[model samples]
Target: MLKYIMQLYKSKRLKVKHAFSSRQGGVSQPPYDSLNLAYHVGDRRDDVVKNHKLFAYEAGFDFKKLVFMNQIHSNKVHVVDEDSFLVPSCDALVTNLCDTPLMVMSADCAPVLFYDEVSKTVAAAHVGRKGAFGNIVKNVLDVMWERFGAEAENIVVAVGPNIKLCCYEVGEKEKSEAKNLGYGFALSGAHLDIDAIIAHQLQKEGVLKEHVEFLPHCTCCESERFFSYRAQGETGRNAAVIVLEDYV
Candidate 1:
C-alpha cells in the first residue's frame, strides 16, 4: 500500500485535525502521478476516489464526513454548521461544526486554512490571482465573525504552497493593478507575490501577525513535486483540509 505522506498541522492551541497533501504517494498515474485528491481535474474518477480514501485513511479522518468546496475563484464564502458531504459552490468554506472536515483544492494556487481556538471554528479557502485580488481572506474573516463568534485576533491561519512571485509573472496592467491595491511590495517587475498579498490581507483584517504562517513552497518552480497549473497548463490539484477535533 502506497501511503500518502501528509503535512499534518500542529498547533498547541487549536484542537483540529488538519493536513495538506502533496503530489507524491498514491495510485494515480502519468500527469497526476499519484495522490491527486481533486475530481475536477482530468484525472480518472476512480483514481481520485482512491486517492481520497487513502488520504483519509492515512490522515485518520472519515472520508464520508468531509465537506468540499466547489471553488469559483470568487470572494463568496459559505458557512457550514452541519455534518454533511454537500459541496458548496463558493470559494471559501467556514464552519463551526465539529468533526466536519472542510476542504479546498488547488493547482498553482494558494490553499489556506483558518482556525479560531477561542470559538473552536475552522475554515478553508482556495485562492489564486482572482481570489487574491478579491480579498477572499477578509470575506472569510467576516463570515467567521458574523456567524460564529470568531475574532480576527483569535484566528490562526496557515497558507499552503502556491506559485510565488518568482514564477507568477503577470502583464503590465495586472502589475499596475497590484501596485494600486497597496501591494507594491508584491511586485517584482512583472511578477506578483500572490501569497504575500494574501498574508497582508490577513493582517489587514486584524489577524495577528504571529498567527499567520505561510509555507515558502513555490508550486511552479517545484512543479515536479507539487502540481502547478501555471507550469503544466493542465495538471492535478492538491488539497488542503481542516476539521474540528470533537465529532458530533
Candidate 2:
C-alpha cells in the first residue's frame, strides 16, 4: 500500500476530496525510481499500472473513475459530463458531477485542484508556462462559473507542489511572452513564479484571495519528495488528484 503524503482541509456538508502527492511510496527504478505515476515517460508499463493502482487505493479512490488528460499545455478546459468521462488532448477539466476523480500530471508544472461545494463542481488544472500564458486558470474559472453556477467566492483552490522561481529559469523568449501579456515583471530570470502568476489570474477571474491555498514546496528543491522535470530532464511524473466521493 502506498503511503499518502497529502494535506487536507476539513469541511462538512460536502463530498469534495483532494490530495497533492509526493514522489514516494511506490515501485519504479532509478532516474524514474519509485512512485512515478505517468506511463508515457518510458517507465515500465506494468509498474506504471501498479503504481496507479497503489495511488488510487492510498488516496481512497477507485482506479476506474480516475480521469486524466493528455496535458497539451493549452488553455482548453474540458467540461466533463456523463458522455465525456475521458476527454482527449486537454490541459484542464471541470465537472459538476460527483464521484469522478479528476487529476492533473506534473513534474515541474503546477497542479491546481479546485472545488466549489455550493455548485457541486470540481476541477483539476495543469498550469505550465505555456498554459499560464494562455490563461488556462481563467478558462477553468469561466467554465466553472458558467456550467455549474460556481461563485468565485465559494471556490477553494489549492496550488500543489511545483517548480518555484528558484529553479524555473527561462530564456529571453519565454520572458518576452509574459512581458507582452502585460505581466512583464512576473518572471525573474533563471526563475519564474508560475504559481503566483496563476494565483493572480484567479484573482483576476474574481476568485477571492483568501479562498486560495498555496503549497510552498518546490519540486526542484525537494526532488527527493516530488518529481522535478527541470531538475531531472526526461524524467518521471507525479499526480495531484481530487475526487468527490459519495457523502456519508
Candidate 3:
C-alpha cells in the first residue's frame, strides 16, 4: 500500500506485502533530501523515526512490528523470532513467524528479500560487495534450508534495486577481495558485477533462475529516484522491506 512501491515476484503466493522504496514519499531534507530510512547517516534521529513511521504506515505494517539491523557488511544472518526485534547489529534476518517485518537498508548494496510460500517464511539480507565476497547469499540459503525447512527450490527471491555494474566501477582492491574469496573473475581493468555475482551464487545454491526476480534499477544512474552511496557519499538509504500480515 506504499505510494512508492515495487512488488516482488510471486509476492501474492506468500500472502504478504513488501516494497523496494525509492527516494520519494517521506520527510528528510537535502543531501538526505526526503525518504532517507537510516539513522546513522547524519540525519536527525527524530526525523528518521518519523520517516520510519510514515514508511510503516504506507507499507501496511505497525511501527512496532518493524525491525532493523546495524548492518556491518559481514556474512552474518540473524535468525529472528519474537525476541529478535530488540537486538541489532546483524546484516540479515530470517523469520518463520508472522506479523514481524524484516528490513534491509541499502544505498547501493543489493537488498535481497526471500519468501517460502510452502513454509510461509520470510527473510531479508544486505549484500554489499564485501558481503558478496563473503558469500552472503550462499550463507542465507544455507540457513534457510537448514533451519526453517525451506527448500532452495521453493524459496522465492527478489533482489531489490542497487548500483549496477556500469556505474559500479571498482578498484583493484575490490577485485582482489573477490578473488581472495575464490569466487568471481577479474576483468582487465578491475571492474566487477556485484549483481551478477549475487545471481550466480543464488543459482549455485539451487534457486531457480526464473524464481529469482531482480528490480534492475541502478541507484547511481537513476539518482532522481533511488539513493546511491557511491554517487552520493553519506546520503540517504533506501530500504527493502517485507512482512506477513494476518490478512492479504
Candidate 4:
C-alpha cells in the first residue's frame, strides 16, 4: 500500500478531518507526474481515478463518498444531501453529514476547507481570482449558516497552498475589479494578494481571525511538489477535502 502524505493543518480543533493534497504520491506520468486528481485536466482517466483512490485511502475515507465540484469559478455554493442531485455547476460544497467528504480541487487556485465544531458541518471551496474578489467565500459561509446552522464565529478555516502575491500578477482590468470591490488594499504593484482578500472577507463575514489557518506555500513557487496551472499550462490539480471529524 502506498502512503500519500496529505497536508493537514495544525488547527486548534483536532477533530477537523480535512487535508490538502500535493502533486506527489500517485502513478500519473510526468507534468501530471504522480498524483493529479482532476479528470478534466486531460490526464488519463484511469490514472486520475487511481490517484483519487490513493488519496482517499491515505486519508482514511471512502472514495465513493467524496463529493467534488465541477467548478465554474462562480460564487455558487451547494448544500449537499444524500439525494440532492449531483451538483455539477458549483464552486463550493457544504455538508453536515458524516462520512460525506467535500472536496475542492485546484492548480494555482486556492482550495479552502472549513470545519464548524458547533454545527458539525464541513465545507470545501475552489477559490481563484474571481472567487477571491467575488462572493464565493461569503456564499459558502451563507449556505453553511443558513442550511446547516454552522456559525461563522465557530468556523475554523484552513486555506491550502495556492498562488499568493509573490506570483499572483494580475492585469489592470482585474486590478480595477478588485478596487471596485473595495479590496484595492490587497493590490501590491501588479500582484494581487489573494490571502489578504480572503482574510478580510472572512473577518467581514464574522469568522474569527485566530480560527483561520493559511498554509504558507505557493504552488507556482513550489511547482515540483504542488501542481501549478500558471507554472504548467496543461497541468493537473491539487485537492482539498474535509469530512466531519474522524468519520473513517
lDDT of each: 0.84, 0.83, 0.81, 0.86
Across 1-248, the per-residue lDDT of candidate 4 in tens digits comes to: 44555443334443577778888788888678779999998899999999999999987788998888799998888888988748879899988888888889999898888888888888889999888877689999999888989889998888889998999899999989999999999999999999999999999999999889888999999997889989988888888888875446
TM-score of 4: 0.94
lDDT of 4 at 171: 94
TM-score of each: 0.92, 0.92, 0.90, 0.94
The better-scoring model by TM-score among 2 and 3 is 2
Q: lDDT of model 1 at residue 156? A: 92
TM-score of 2: 0.92
lDDT of 3 by residue, 79-108 (tens): 887665675677889888778888899999
Q: In model 3, which runs have C-alpha deviations exceeding 4 angstroms?
A: 1-15, 185-188
| lDDT at residue 75 of model 3 (Cα atoms) | 92
lDDT string, candidate 2, 1-248, tens digits: 45544322222322467777777767888677677888889999998888888888888888988899988879999988998876899999998777788989999899988888887889999999999999899889899998889999888888888899888888888878888996766777556778878888999888888888888889999997888998888778888888876675
Candidate 1 lDDT over 3-69, as tens digits, reads 5554433443345678878888778987886788888878899999998988888777888988897
Which order, best to worst by lDDT? 4, 1, 2, 3
Residue 25 lDDT in candidate 4 = 83
Question: TM-score: which candidate is best?
Answer: 4
Candidate 2 error regions (>4 Å): 1-15
Q: Distance (Å) between predicted and true CA of 199, model 1? A: 1.7
Q: Can you tell me which runs of candidate 1 are displaced by over 4 Å?
A: 1-15, 83-85
